[model samples]
Target: MYSTSTQKREWTYTPEKLAAVRLETNIKFREKYESVITPEELELFVTPEEELRMQRSIEDAALKFADKFRPHIWPSVKWTALAFFKRAFLVWMVMMGCFYLAMKIDEFYITIDDFVKNMNVGDPRQNAERILKLEPELMKVLNYNLTVHCPYRPFEGHLMDMKTRMLLLNFDLESIRRDSMRFFQNALQTDVLLVYPPSQIALAAINFGCMLKSDEILREFLRKMIGIEEDSWSARDVRPEDLEKLEKTVTRVNHIMREVEKQFVAVTEQERENHKSRLSQIQNLLPILNERRKEAWRAGGCIGQEPGLVTEAPVDSDDE
Candidate 1:
Protein backbone atom coordinates (compact mmCIF):
# COMPACT_ATOMS: atom_id res chain seq x y z
CA MET A 1 0.00 0.00 0.00
CA TYR A 2 1.26 3.43 -0.98
CA SER A 3 0.01 6.85 0.04
CA THR A 4 -0.55 9.48 -2.69
CA SER A 5 0.40 13.07 -1.86
CA THR A 6 -2.36 15.69 -2.22
CA GLN A 7 0.26 18.15 -3.43
CA LYS A 8 -0.14 18.12 -7.23
CA ARG A 9 3.18 18.67 -8.98
CA GLU A 10 5.16 17.93 -12.15
CA TRP A 11 6.42 14.34 -12.56
CA THR A 12 10.02 13.06 -12.49
CA TYR A 13 11.65 9.65 -11.98
CA THR A 14 15.22 8.41 -12.30
CA PRO A 15 16.23 5.03 -13.79
CA GLU A 16 17.22 3.98 -10.25
CA LYS A 17 13.67 4.58 -9.01
CA LEU A 18 12.15 2.40 -11.75
CA ALA A 19 14.79 -0.28 -11.20
CA ALA A 20 14.10 -0.27 -7.42
CA VAL A 21 10.39 -0.84 -8.03
CA ARG A 22 11.09 -3.75 -10.40
CA LEU A 23 13.49 -5.33 -7.91
CA GLU A 24 11.01 -5.02 -5.06
CA THR A 25 8.21 -6.61 -7.12
CA ASN A 26 10.47 -9.50 -8.17
CA ILE A 27 11.47 -10.14 -4.53
CA LYS A 28 7.88 -10.10 -3.28
CA PHE A 29 6.73 -12.58 -5.95
CA ARG A 30 9.65 -14.89 -5.16
CA GLU A 31 8.88 -14.81 -1.41
CA LYS A 32 5.21 -15.49 -1.91
CA TYR A 33 5.51 -18.44 -4.37
CA GLU A 34 8.88 -20.07 -3.64
CA SER A 35 7.71 -22.43 -0.80
CA VAL A 36 4.59 -23.70 -2.54
CA ILE A 37 5.79 -23.74 -6.18
CA THR A 38 8.95 -25.43 -7.45
CA PRO A 39 10.63 -23.87 -10.48
CA GLU A 40 9.02 -26.49 -12.82
CA GLU A 41 5.64 -25.99 -11.19
CA LEU A 42 5.94 -22.24 -11.52
CA GLU A 43 6.69 -22.60 -15.22
CA LEU A 44 3.64 -24.89 -15.64
CA PHE A 45 1.48 -22.44 -13.69
CA VAL A 46 1.92 -19.86 -16.45
CA THR A 47 -0.37 -21.74 -18.96
CA PRO A 48 -1.78 -19.81 -21.95
CA GLU A 49 -4.98 -18.77 -20.03
CA GLU A 50 -2.98 -17.95 -16.89
CA GLU A 51 -0.37 -16.15 -18.98
CA LEU A 52 -3.07 -13.94 -20.54
CA ARG A 53 -4.52 -13.20 -17.07
CA MET A 54 -1.01 -12.45 -15.69
CA GLN A 55 -0.32 -10.14 -18.64
CA ARG A 56 -3.59 -8.26 -17.94
CA SER A 57 -2.67 -8.02 -14.23
CA ILE A 58 0.80 -6.72 -15.11
CA GLU A 59 -0.74 -4.14 -17.47
CA ASP A 60 -3.27 -3.03 -14.81
CA ALA A 61 -0.49 -2.79 -12.18
CA ALA A 62 1.68 -0.77 -14.56
CA LEU A 63 -1.23 1.62 -15.33
CA LYS A 64 -1.94 2.04 -11.59
CA PHE A 65 1.73 2.57 -10.85
CA ALA A 66 1.97 5.17 -13.65
CA ASP A 67 -1.18 6.99 -12.57
CA LYS A 68 0.07 7.15 -8.98
CA PHE A 69 3.60 8.33 -9.88
CA ARG A 70 3.30 9.89 -13.33
CA PRO A 71 3.73 13.38 -11.89
CA HIS A 72 6.96 12.27 -10.20
CA ILE A 73 8.25 10.34 -13.24
CA TRP A 74 7.51 12.70 -16.15
CA PRO A 75 10.77 14.64 -16.47
CA SER A 76 13.79 12.30 -16.54
CA VAL A 77 11.88 9.22 -17.69
CA LYS A 78 10.38 11.02 -20.72
CA TRP A 79 13.78 12.19 -21.96
CA THR A 80 15.48 8.91 -21.02
CA ALA A 81 12.87 6.89 -22.90
CA LEU A 82 13.14 9.16 -25.94
CA ALA A 83 16.94 8.87 -25.85
CA PHE A 84 16.74 5.11 -25.59
CA PHE A 85 14.39 4.91 -28.56
CA LYS A 86 16.40 7.40 -30.59
CA ARG A 87 19.67 5.50 -30.11
CA ALA A 88 18.28 2.09 -30.98
CA PHE A 89 20.55 0.56 -33.65
CA LEU A 90 18.08 0.94 -36.53
CA VAL A 91 17.10 4.51 -35.49
CA TRP A 92 20.75 5.58 -35.14
CA MET A 93 21.64 4.19 -38.58
CA VAL A 94 18.78 6.10 -40.21
CA MET A 95 19.73 9.33 -38.41
CA MET A 96 23.38 9.01 -39.50
CA GLY A 97 22.36 8.41 -43.11
CA CYS A 98 20.20 11.56 -43.10
CA PHE A 99 23.04 13.59 -41.55
CA TYR A 100 25.48 12.41 -44.23
CA LEU A 101 23.04 13.30 -47.01
CA ALA A 102 22.56 16.80 -45.59
CA MET A 103 26.35 17.34 -45.48
CA LYS A 104 26.65 16.16 -49.08
CA ILE A 105 23.97 18.68 -50.18
CA ASP A 106 26.04 21.64 -48.89
CA GLU A 107 29.52 20.20 -49.57
CA PHE A 108 30.17 22.34 -52.67
CA TYR A 109 29.10 25.54 -50.90
CA ILE A 110 31.38 24.71 -47.97
CA THR A 111 34.37 24.15 -50.30
CA ILE A 112 33.82 27.47 -52.10
CA ASP A 113 33.48 29.39 -48.85
CA ASP A 114 36.66 27.82 -47.51
CA PHE A 115 38.62 28.74 -50.67
CA VAL A 116 37.38 32.36 -50.78
CA LYS A 117 37.95 32.93 -47.08
CA ASN A 118 41.46 31.45 -47.12
CA MET A 119 42.57 32.95 -50.42
CA ASN A 120 41.35 36.41 -49.43
CA VAL A 121 42.71 39.31 -51.57
CA GLY A 122 44.47 41.06 -48.69
CA ASP A 123 48.13 40.65 -47.65
CA PRO A 124 49.49 37.20 -48.47
CA ARG A 125 51.55 37.28 -45.26
CA GLN A 126 48.39 37.79 -43.19
CA ASN A 127 46.69 34.99 -45.07
CA ALA A 128 49.75 32.75 -44.67
CA GLU A 129 50.00 33.54 -40.96
CA ARG A 130 46.33 32.70 -40.45
CA ILE A 131 46.49 29.51 -42.50
CA LEU A 132 49.69 28.43 -40.73
CA LYS A 133 47.92 28.87 -37.40
CA LEU A 134 44.76 27.03 -38.38
CA GLU A 135 45.90 24.43 -40.88
CA PRO A 136 49.68 24.11 -41.04
CA GLU A 137 49.63 21.20 -43.49
CA LEU A 138 47.44 23.12 -45.91
CA MET A 139 49.74 26.13 -45.61
CA LYS A 140 52.65 23.88 -46.38
CA VAL A 141 50.86 22.63 -49.49
CA LEU A 142 50.16 26.18 -50.65
CA ASN A 143 53.73 27.27 -49.99
CA TYR A 144 55.03 24.31 -51.96
CA ASN A 145 52.67 24.94 -54.86
CA LEU A 146 53.43 28.68 -54.99
CA THR A 147 57.17 28.04 -55.02
CA VAL A 148 56.90 25.48 -57.84
CA HIS A 149 54.41 27.33 -60.05
CA CYS A 150 55.80 30.90 -59.68
CA PRO A 151 59.46 31.62 -60.38
CA TYR A 152 59.53 35.04 -62.06
CA ARG A 153 62.00 36.83 -59.77
CA PRO A 154 64.55 34.77 -57.81
CA PHE A 155 64.39 37.03 -54.75
CA GLU A 156 60.59 37.10 -54.81
CA GLY A 157 60.68 33.35 -55.48
CA HIS A 158 62.96 32.91 -52.46
CA LEU A 159 60.67 35.13 -50.36
CA MET A 160 57.77 32.85 -51.26
CA ASP A 161 60.06 29.90 -50.64
CA MET A 162 60.75 30.99 -47.02
CA LYS A 163 57.27 29.99 -45.78
CA THR A 164 58.29 26.35 -45.85
CA ARG A 165 61.85 27.20 -44.78
CA MET A 166 60.61 29.13 -41.74
CA LEU A 167 58.45 26.17 -40.76
CA LEU A 168 61.50 23.94 -41.06
CA LEU A 169 64.27 26.26 -39.72
CA ASN A 170 63.05 26.61 -36.12
CA PHE A 171 65.42 29.62 -36.00
CA ASP A 172 66.33 31.88 -33.08
CA LEU A 173 64.89 35.40 -32.86
CA GLU A 174 67.92 36.93 -34.57
CA SER A 175 67.77 34.45 -37.44
CA ILE A 176 64.03 34.95 -37.80
CA ARG A 177 64.58 38.73 -38.00
CA ARG A 178 67.25 38.32 -40.66
CA ASP A 179 65.14 35.92 -42.72
CA SER A 180 62.02 38.09 -42.41
CA MET A 181 63.98 41.17 -43.58
CA ARG A 182 65.31 39.24 -46.54
CA PHE A 183 61.83 38.00 -47.39
CA PHE A 184 60.28 41.50 -47.18
CA GLN A 185 63.01 42.98 -49.38
CA ASN A 186 62.38 40.29 -51.93
CA ALA A 187 58.62 40.78 -51.66
CA LEU A 188 58.82 44.57 -52.24
CA GLN A 189 60.82 44.30 -55.50
CA THR A 190 58.50 41.84 -57.22
CA ASP A 191 55.49 42.81 -59.35
CA VAL A 192 52.38 43.40 -57.29
CA LEU A 193 50.60 40.05 -57.25
CA LEU A 194 48.47 41.57 -54.49
CA VAL A 195 48.06 45.33 -54.49
CA TYR A 196 48.68 46.73 -50.99
CA PRO A 197 48.83 50.37 -49.96
CA PRO A 198 51.82 51.95 -48.16
CA SER A 199 49.76 51.78 -44.96
CA GLN A 200 49.45 48.01 -45.32
CA ILE A 201 53.14 47.67 -46.15
CA ALA A 202 53.92 49.86 -43.14
CA LEU A 203 51.76 47.59 -41.02
CA ALA A 204 53.69 44.54 -42.15
CA ALA A 205 57.00 46.35 -41.62
CA ILE A 206 55.90 47.43 -38.15
CA ASN A 207 54.93 43.89 -37.31
CA PHE A 208 58.24 42.56 -38.58
CA GLY A 209 60.13 45.40 -36.89
CA CYS A 210 58.53 44.60 -33.56
CA MET A 211 59.56 40.99 -33.97
CA LEU A 212 63.13 42.18 -34.69
CA LYS A 213 63.25 44.52 -31.65
CA SER A 214 63.40 47.58 -33.92
CA ASP A 215 60.60 49.68 -32.45
CA GLU A 216 62.10 52.97 -33.70
CA ILE A 217 62.21 51.81 -37.33
CA LEU A 218 58.76 50.30 -36.96
CA ARG A 219 57.40 53.66 -35.79
CA GLU A 220 59.14 55.52 -38.61
CA PHE A 221 57.94 52.98 -41.19
CA LEU A 222 54.40 53.28 -39.84
CA ARG A 223 54.56 57.07 -40.09
CA LYS A 224 55.88 57.02 -43.67
CA MET A 225 53.63 54.14 -44.70
CA ILE A 226 50.59 55.99 -43.39
CA GLY A 227 51.65 59.17 -45.29
CA ILE A 228 52.72 61.29 -42.32
CA GLU A 229 55.78 62.78 -43.94
CA GLU A 230 58.53 64.17 -41.73
CA ASP A 231 61.40 65.19 -44.04
CA SER A 232 61.86 63.01 -47.15
CA TRP A 233 59.14 63.54 -49.76
CA SER A 234 57.13 65.38 -47.09
CA ALA A 235 55.19 67.54 -49.58
CA ARG A 236 54.14 64.58 -51.69
CA ASP A 237 50.51 63.46 -51.30
CA VAL A 238 50.76 59.75 -50.47
CA ARG A 239 47.59 58.47 -52.04
CA PRO A 240 46.68 54.91 -53.12
CA GLU A 241 47.81 55.79 -56.63
CA ASP A 242 51.12 56.97 -55.21
CA LEU A 243 51.58 53.63 -53.49
CA GLU A 244 50.76 51.83 -56.77
CA LYS A 245 53.27 54.07 -58.53
CA LEU A 246 55.86 53.31 -55.86
CA GLU A 247 55.28 49.62 -56.50
CA LYS A 248 55.93 50.12 -60.21
CA THR A 249 58.91 52.34 -59.55
CA VAL A 250 60.66 49.60 -57.56
CA THR A 251 60.42 46.77 -60.13
CA ARG A 252 64.14 46.06 -60.43
CA VAL A 253 65.38 43.36 -58.05
CA ASN A 254 68.28 45.72 -57.17
CA HIS A 255 65.89 48.46 -55.95
CA ILE A 256 64.39 45.99 -53.50
CA MET A 257 67.86 44.93 -52.28
CA ARG A 258 68.87 48.58 -51.59
CA GLU A 259 65.69 49.24 -49.61
CA VAL A 260 66.31 46.01 -47.72
CA GLU A 261 69.83 47.22 -46.88
CA LYS A 262 68.46 50.54 -45.66
CA GLN A 263 65.80 48.83 -43.54
CA PHE A 264 68.36 46.33 -42.17
CA VAL A 265 70.58 49.25 -41.05
CA ALA A 266 67.55 50.99 -39.55
CA VAL A 267 66.53 47.91 -37.56
CA THR A 268 69.80 46.19 -36.55
CA GLU A 269 70.27 45.73 -32.80
CA GLN A 270 73.07 47.51 -30.84
CA GLU A 271 73.48 44.39 -28.69
CA ARG A 272 73.90 42.27 -31.86
CA GLU A 273 76.71 44.62 -33.00
CA ASN A 274 79.25 42.74 -30.84
CA HIS A 275 78.43 39.40 -32.47
CA LYS A 276 81.21 39.25 -35.12
CA SER A 277 79.87 36.29 -37.10
CA ARG A 278 76.37 37.74 -37.36
CA LEU A 279 77.75 41.19 -38.15
CA SER A 280 79.87 39.68 -40.94
CA GLN A 281 76.76 37.99 -42.41
CA ILE A 282 74.90 41.34 -42.28
CA GLN A 283 77.90 43.07 -43.90
CA ASN A 284 77.98 40.49 -46.69
CA LEU A 285 74.24 40.82 -47.28
CA LEU A 286 74.34 44.65 -47.47
CA PRO A 287 76.26 44.94 -50.77
CA ILE A 288 74.08 42.24 -52.31
CA LEU A 289 70.96 44.17 -51.27
CA ASN A 290 72.37 47.46 -52.67
CA GLU A 291 73.10 45.83 -56.03
CA ARG A 292 69.57 44.39 -56.13
CA ARG A 293 68.15 47.86 -55.38
CA LYS A 294 70.21 49.38 -58.25
CA GLU A 295 68.94 46.68 -60.62
CA ALA A 296 65.37 47.32 -59.44
CA TRP A 297 65.80 51.08 -59.96
CA ARG A 298 67.04 50.59 -63.53
CA ALA A 299 64.16 48.21 -64.28
CA GLY A 300 61.66 50.69 -62.82
CA GLY A 301 63.28 53.70 -64.62
CA CYS A 302 60.45 53.73 -67.18
CA ILE A 303 57.90 54.51 -64.45
CA GLY A 304 60.11 57.30 -63.00
CA GLN A 305 60.61 58.68 -66.52
CA GLU A 306 56.93 59.61 -66.52
CA PRO A 307 56.79 62.93 -64.64
CA GLY A 308 54.15 63.34 -61.90
CA LEU A 309 53.88 59.57 -61.51
CA VAL A 310 54.85 59.76 -57.82
CA THR A 311 52.77 62.91 -57.18
CA GLU A 312 49.22 62.51 -55.90
CA ALA A 313 46.05 64.64 -55.52
CA PRO A 314 46.52 67.50 -53.05
CA VAL A 315 45.11 67.13 -49.57
CA ASP A 316 42.31 69.63 -48.79
CA SER A 317 43.83 72.36 -46.60
CA ASP A 318 40.41 73.31 -45.23
CA ASP A 319 39.70 69.69 -44.27
CA GLU A 320 43.07 69.38 -42.55
Candidate 2:
Protein backbone atom coordinates (compact mmCIF):
# COMPACT_ATOMS: atom_id res chain seq x y z
CA MET A 1 0.00 0.00 0.00
CA TYR A 2 2.93 2.32 0.67
CA SER A 3 3.87 2.04 -2.98
CA THR A 4 0.51 3.57 -3.87
CA SER A 5 0.33 5.97 -0.93
CA THR A 6 0.59 9.74 -0.84
CA GLN A 7 3.53 9.42 1.50
CA LYS A 8 5.52 7.74 -1.21
CA ARG A 9 4.53 10.26 -3.82
CA GLU A 10 4.86 13.50 -1.90
CA TRP A 11 6.65 13.01 1.40
CA THR A 12 9.49 10.69 0.54
CA TYR A 13 12.81 12.26 -0.36
CA THR A 14 16.17 10.92 -1.42
CA PRO A 15 19.24 11.60 0.70
CA GLU A 16 20.42 14.32 -1.66
CA LYS A 17 17.01 15.96 -1.66
CA LEU A 18 16.89 15.89 2.11
CA ALA A 19 20.28 17.56 2.39
CA ALA A 20 19.40 20.15 -0.25
CA VAL A 21 16.12 20.93 1.50
CA ARG A 22 17.90 21.52 4.79
CA LEU A 23 20.43 23.75 3.11
CA GLU A 24 17.71 25.79 1.44
CA THR A 25 15.78 26.13 4.68
CA ASN A 26 18.85 27.46 6.45
CA ILE A 27 19.53 29.90 3.63
CA LYS A 28 15.97 31.17 3.78
CA PHE A 29 16.25 31.73 7.52
CA ARG A 30 19.31 33.91 7.08
CA GLU A 31 17.82 35.78 4.13
CA LYS A 32 14.69 36.56 6.14
CA TYR A 33 16.58 38.07 9.08
CA GLU A 34 19.82 39.42 7.66
CA SER A 35 18.38 42.93 7.26
CA VAL A 36 16.55 43.03 10.57
CA ILE A 37 19.19 41.64 12.98
CA THR A 38 22.83 42.49 13.57
CA PRO A 39 25.53 40.13 12.31
CA GLU A 40 26.35 39.29 15.95
CA GLU A 41 22.72 38.39 16.60
CA LEU A 42 22.64 36.27 13.47
CA GLU A 43 25.73 34.44 14.63
CA LEU A 44 23.79 33.17 17.63
CA PHE A 45 21.46 31.09 15.48
CA VAL A 46 21.76 27.34 15.89
CA THR A 47 23.15 25.37 12.98
CA PRO A 48 20.93 22.87 11.18
CA GLU A 49 22.62 19.94 12.94
CA GLU A 50 22.16 21.54 16.35
CA GLU A 51 18.53 22.19 15.57
CA LEU A 52 18.16 18.53 14.59
CA ARG A 53 19.77 17.38 17.84
CA MET A 54 17.43 19.57 19.88
CA GLN A 55 14.40 18.24 18.05
CA ARG A 56 15.61 14.67 18.56
CA SER A 57 15.86 15.27 22.32
CA ILE A 58 12.31 16.60 22.44
CA GLU A 59 11.15 13.70 20.24
CA ASP A 60 12.74 11.13 22.55
CA ALA A 61 11.00 12.70 25.56
CA ALA A 62 7.68 12.57 23.69
CA LEU A 63 8.28 8.92 22.84
CA LYS A 64 8.84 8.16 26.54
CA PHE A 65 5.55 9.86 27.37
CA ALA A 66 3.77 7.87 24.68
CA ASP A 67 5.20 4.63 26.05
CA LYS A 68 3.73 5.29 29.50
CA PHE A 69 0.38 6.62 28.26
CA ARG A 70 -2.63 4.91 29.72
CA PRO A 71 -4.67 2.30 27.80
CA HIS A 72 -1.56 1.50 25.80
CA ILE A 73 -1.03 3.58 22.67
CA TRP A 74 -0.63 1.71 19.38
CA PRO A 75 2.75 1.46 17.69
CA SER A 76 1.23 2.96 14.55
CA VAL A 77 0.03 5.95 16.54
CA LYS A 78 3.44 6.50 18.07
CA TRP A 79 5.12 6.27 14.67
CA THR A 80 2.64 8.67 13.13
CA ALA A 81 3.13 11.11 15.98
CA LEU A 82 6.90 11.00 15.51
CA ALA A 83 6.47 11.43 11.76
CA PHE A 84 4.66 14.68 12.45
CA PHE A 85 7.38 15.90 14.78
CA LYS A 86 10.09 15.08 12.21
CA ARG A 87 8.19 16.91 9.48
CA ALA A 88 8.01 20.13 11.48
CA PHE A 89 10.40 21.69 13.94
CA LEU A 90 7.92 22.60 16.66
CA VAL A 91 8.31 23.51 20.31
CA TRP A 92 7.62 21.09 23.14
CA MET A 93 3.99 22.21 23.53
CA VAL A 94 3.21 21.88 19.84
CA MET A 95 4.98 18.51 19.77
CA MET A 96 2.55 17.28 22.46
CA GLY A 97 -0.29 18.71 20.40
CA CYS A 98 0.98 16.69 17.44
CA PHE A 99 0.95 13.55 19.59
CA TYR A 100 -2.62 14.25 20.68
CA LEU A 101 -3.64 14.80 17.09
CA ALA A 102 -1.95 11.57 16.02
CA MET A 103 -3.86 9.69 18.75
CA LYS A 104 -7.21 11.06 17.65
CA ILE A 105 -6.47 10.34 14.03
CA ASP A 106 -5.51 6.79 14.94
CA GLU A 107 -8.88 6.44 16.77
CA PHE A 108 -7.25 6.31 20.21
CA TYR A 109 -9.27 9.17 21.57
CA ILE A 110 -8.68 10.45 25.11
CA THR A 111 -10.34 13.49 26.62
CA ILE A 112 -8.20 16.62 26.74
CA ASP A 113 -8.29 16.68 30.52
CA ASP A 114 -7.31 13.02 30.67
CA PHE A 115 -4.48 13.64 28.23
CA VAL A 116 -3.17 16.54 30.31
CA LYS A 117 -3.40 14.57 33.54
CA ASN A 118 -1.99 11.37 32.13
CA MET A 119 0.85 13.18 30.40
CA ASN A 120 1.56 15.07 33.66
CA VAL A 121 1.41 18.41 31.94
CA GLY A 122 1.02 21.04 34.67
CA ASP A 123 -2.25 23.02 34.82
CA PRO A 124 -4.65 20.81 32.90
CA ARG A 125 -6.95 23.58 31.72
CA GLN A 126 -4.12 25.83 30.48
CA ASN A 127 -2.30 22.95 28.86
CA ALA A 128 -5.48 21.75 27.19
CA GLU A 129 -6.13 25.26 25.93
CA ARG A 130 -2.61 25.50 24.55
CA ILE A 131 -2.88 22.13 22.85
CA LEU A 132 -6.22 22.97 21.30
CA LYS A 133 -4.97 26.30 20.00
CA LEU A 134 -1.97 24.67 18.37
CA GLU A 135 -3.85 21.68 16.97
CA PRO A 136 -4.73 23.42 13.71
CA GLU A 137 -1.14 24.53 13.19
CA LEU A 138 0.10 21.01 13.75
CA MET A 139 -2.44 19.64 11.31
CA LYS A 140 -1.45 22.23 8.73
CA VAL A 141 2.21 21.41 9.16
CA LEU A 142 1.41 17.74 8.52
CA ASN A 143 -0.69 18.79 5.53
CA TYR A 144 -3.60 16.93 7.17
CA ASN A 145 -2.03 13.60 6.23
CA LEU A 146 -2.78 11.26 9.12
CA THR A 147 -2.08 7.85 7.64
CA VAL A 148 1.41 6.52 8.42
CA HIS A 149 2.49 2.96 7.68
CA CYS A 150 5.06 1.62 10.15
CA PRO A 151 7.41 -1.35 9.88
CA TYR A 152 5.94 -3.40 12.75
CA ARG A 153 3.45 -5.36 10.66
CA PRO A 154 5.96 -6.07 7.94
CA PHE A 155 8.42 -7.02 10.66
CA GLU A 156 5.99 -9.61 11.95
CA GLY A 157 5.41 -10.80 8.42
CA HIS A 158 9.12 -11.40 7.96
CA LEU A 159 9.14 -13.50 11.16
CA MET A 160 6.14 -15.47 9.98
CA ASP A 161 7.81 -16.01 6.63
CA MET A 162 10.91 -17.35 8.27
CA LYS A 163 8.98 -19.74 10.50
CA THR A 164 6.86 -21.08 7.67
CA ARG A 165 9.28 -21.15 4.75
CA MET A 166 12.78 -21.46 6.17
CA LEU A 167 13.05 -25.01 7.58
CA LEU A 168 16.64 -24.31 8.49
CA LEU A 169 15.52 -21.74 11.06
CA ASN A 170 14.09 -24.52 13.25
CA PHE A 171 14.77 -22.76 16.53
CA ASP A 172 12.18 -20.71 18.37
CA LEU A 173 11.09 -17.73 16.29
CA GLU A 174 10.04 -15.89 19.42
CA SER A 175 13.62 -14.98 20.23
CA ILE A 176 14.11 -13.54 16.78
CA ARG A 177 10.80 -11.67 17.12
CA ARG A 178 11.85 -10.17 20.44
CA ASP A 179 15.22 -9.06 19.15
CA SER A 180 13.65 -7.61 15.99
CA MET A 181 11.15 -5.69 18.10
CA ARG A 182 13.97 -4.10 20.05
CA PHE A 183 15.83 -3.25 16.84
CA PHE A 184 12.68 -1.64 15.48
CA GLN A 185 12.27 0.37 18.70
CA ASN A 186 15.82 1.67 18.39
CA ALA A 187 15.23 2.38 14.69
CA LEU A 188 12.38 4.67 15.66
CA GLN A 189 14.95 7.00 17.20
CA THR A 190 16.79 7.20 13.89
CA ASP A 191 15.71 8.47 10.44
CA VAL A 192 15.29 4.96 9.06
CA LEU A 193 11.52 5.22 9.07
CA LEU A 194 11.67 8.35 6.98
CA VAL A 195 14.47 7.28 4.69
CA TYR A 196 13.69 3.61 3.99
CA PRO A 197 10.63 1.63 2.98
CA PRO A 198 8.85 -0.33 5.69
CA SER A 199 9.67 -3.63 4.01
CA GLN A 200 13.36 -2.79 3.84
CA ILE A 201 13.32 -1.68 7.47
CA ALA A 202 11.61 -4.92 8.38
CA LEU A 203 14.27 -6.88 6.53
CA ALA A 204 17.06 -4.94 8.19
CA ALA A 205 15.55 -5.58 11.63
CA ILE A 206 15.28 -9.30 10.85
CA ASN A 207 18.86 -9.34 9.63
CA PHE A 208 20.06 -7.66 12.82
CA GLY A 209 17.90 -9.94 14.95
CA CYS A 210 19.50 -13.00 13.33
CA MET A 211 22.93 -11.51 13.87
CA LEU A 212 22.14 -11.10 17.56
CA LYS A 213 20.90 -14.69 17.76
CA SER A 214 23.94 -16.39 16.19
CA ASP A 215 26.23 -16.17 13.20
CA GLU A 216 24.91 -19.49 11.80
CA ILE A 217 21.30 -18.28 11.91
CA LEU A 218 22.35 -14.98 10.39
CA ARG A 219 24.08 -16.78 7.51
CA GLU A 220 21.02 -18.91 6.91
CA PHE A 221 18.59 -15.96 6.90
CA LEU A 222 20.83 -13.97 4.60
CA ARG A 223 21.13 -16.99 2.32
CA LYS A 224 17.37 -17.41 2.03
CA MET A 225 16.18 -13.80 2.18
CA ILE A 226 18.99 -12.10 0.32
CA GLY A 227 19.85 -15.03 -1.95
CA ILE A 228 23.53 -14.71 -1.10
CA GLU A 229 24.39 -17.68 -3.28
CA GLU A 230 22.44 -16.21 -6.17
CA ASP A 231 25.26 -13.75 -6.58
CA SER A 232 27.30 -16.58 -8.06
CA TRP A 233 27.91 -16.71 -11.84
CA SER A 234 25.55 -19.71 -12.21
CA ALA A 235 22.54 -17.58 -11.15
CA ARG A 236 20.45 -16.53 -14.12
CA ASP A 237 17.64 -14.45 -12.61
CA VAL A 238 19.25 -12.13 -10.07
CA ARG A 239 21.43 -9.22 -11.04
CA PRO A 240 24.63 -8.75 -9.07
CA GLU A 241 24.22 -4.98 -8.97
CA ASP A 242 20.72 -5.22 -7.50
CA LEU A 243 21.93 -7.63 -4.85
CA GLU A 244 24.83 -5.34 -4.06
CA LYS A 245 22.50 -2.37 -3.73
CA LEU A 246 20.21 -4.25 -1.36
CA GLU A 247 23.12 -5.25 0.84
CA LYS A 248 24.37 -1.67 0.87
CA THR A 249 20.98 -0.37 1.96
CA VAL A 250 20.75 -2.87 4.80
CA THR A 251 24.25 -2.02 5.96
CA ARG A 252 23.41 1.70 5.78
CA VAL A 253 20.36 1.23 7.98
CA ASN A 254 22.41 -0.59 10.62
CA HIS A 255 25.10 2.06 10.39
CA ILE A 256 22.51 4.78 10.87
CA MET A 257 21.15 3.03 13.93
CA ARG A 258 24.59 2.79 15.52
CA GLU A 259 25.55 6.37 14.63
CA VAL A 260 22.33 7.80 15.98
CA GLU A 261 22.65 5.76 19.16
CA LYS A 262 26.14 7.14 19.63
CA GLN A 263 24.85 10.65 19.11
CA PHE A 264 22.09 10.10 21.66
CA VAL A 265 24.54 8.67 24.20
CA ALA A 266 26.96 11.55 23.68
CA VAL A 267 24.39 14.19 24.62
CA THR A 268 25.16 15.36 28.15
CA GLU A 269 23.00 17.38 30.50
CA GLN A 270 25.30 20.35 29.98
CA GLU A 271 24.86 20.03 26.22
CA ARG A 272 21.11 20.13 26.68
CA GLU A 273 21.50 23.15 28.92
CA ASN A 274 23.48 24.83 26.14
CA HIS A 275 20.65 24.06 23.72
CA LYS A 276 18.19 25.70 26.13
CA SER A 277 20.42 28.74 26.37
CA ARG A 278 20.45 29.00 22.59
CA LEU A 279 16.66 28.65 22.56
CA SER A 280 16.38 31.54 25.00
CA GLN A 281 18.40 33.69 22.61
CA ILE A 282 16.04 32.80 19.75
CA GLN A 283 12.99 33.46 21.93
CA ASN A 284 14.31 36.87 22.85
CA LEU A 285 14.96 37.65 19.19
CA LEU A 286 11.52 36.56 17.91
CA PRO A 287 9.52 39.50 19.30
CA ILE A 288 11.76 42.03 17.61
CA LEU A 289 11.59 40.06 14.36
CA ASN A 290 7.79 39.86 14.61
CA GLU A 291 7.52 43.59 15.23
CA ARG A 292 9.68 44.32 12.21
CA ARG A 293 7.54 42.06 10.03
CA LYS A 294 4.42 43.79 11.34
CA GLU A 295 5.88 47.21 10.49
CA ALA A 296 6.76 46.07 6.97
CA TRP A 297 3.28 44.69 6.48
CA ARG A 298 1.71 47.88 7.79
CA ALA A 299 3.80 49.93 5.39
CA GLY A 300 2.33 47.80 2.60
CA GLY A 301 -1.20 48.57 3.91
CA CYS A 302 -1.66 45.06 5.20
CA ILE A 303 -2.49 44.82 8.91
CA GLY A 304 -1.07 41.80 10.73
CA GLN A 305 -1.34 40.55 14.29
CA GLU A 306 1.55 39.35 16.39
CA PRO A 307 1.93 35.56 16.39
CA GLY A 308 3.12 32.90 18.88
CA LEU A 309 1.70 34.84 21.84
CA VAL A 310 -0.53 32.77 24.13
CA THR A 311 -2.98 34.54 26.39
CA GLU A 312 -3.53 32.39 29.45
CA ALA A 313 -6.91 32.62 31.12
CA PRO A 314 -7.78 31.50 34.63
CA VAL A 315 -9.08 27.95 34.44
CA ASP A 316 -9.66 24.90 36.61
CA SER A 317 -6.48 23.82 38.39
CA ASP A 318 -7.84 20.36 39.22
CA ASP A 319 -8.63 18.50 36.00
CA GLU A 320 -9.29 15.25 37.76
Best by TM-score: 2
lDDT leader: 2
Per-residue accuracy of model 2 over 1-320 as CA lDDT, tens digit each: 88877566656777667667666776777676776677888888767776777766666667778889887888878888887777665222257888888888779888888888876646888999988999976766655555677888887887876786667655787777777767766666666666777877777677767775664554455556665663466656666775676567657656655644554443466776777688778889978987886676667787554433445444322111
Q: lDDT score of model 2?
A: 0.70
State the displacement of the C-alpha of residue 57, model 2, in Å, after optimal TM-score superposition: 1.4
Clashing pairs in 2: none
lDDT of 1 at 217: 40
Score each candidate by Cα lDDT: 0.33, 0.70
What tens digits encode model 1's per-residue C-alpha lDDT throughout 63-159?
A: 2332344223332232222222112211111111221122232231233233324332456556445433534232122221111111113323333
TM-score of each: 0.15, 0.79
lDDT of 2 at 8: 68
* Residue 27 local lDDT, model 1: 56
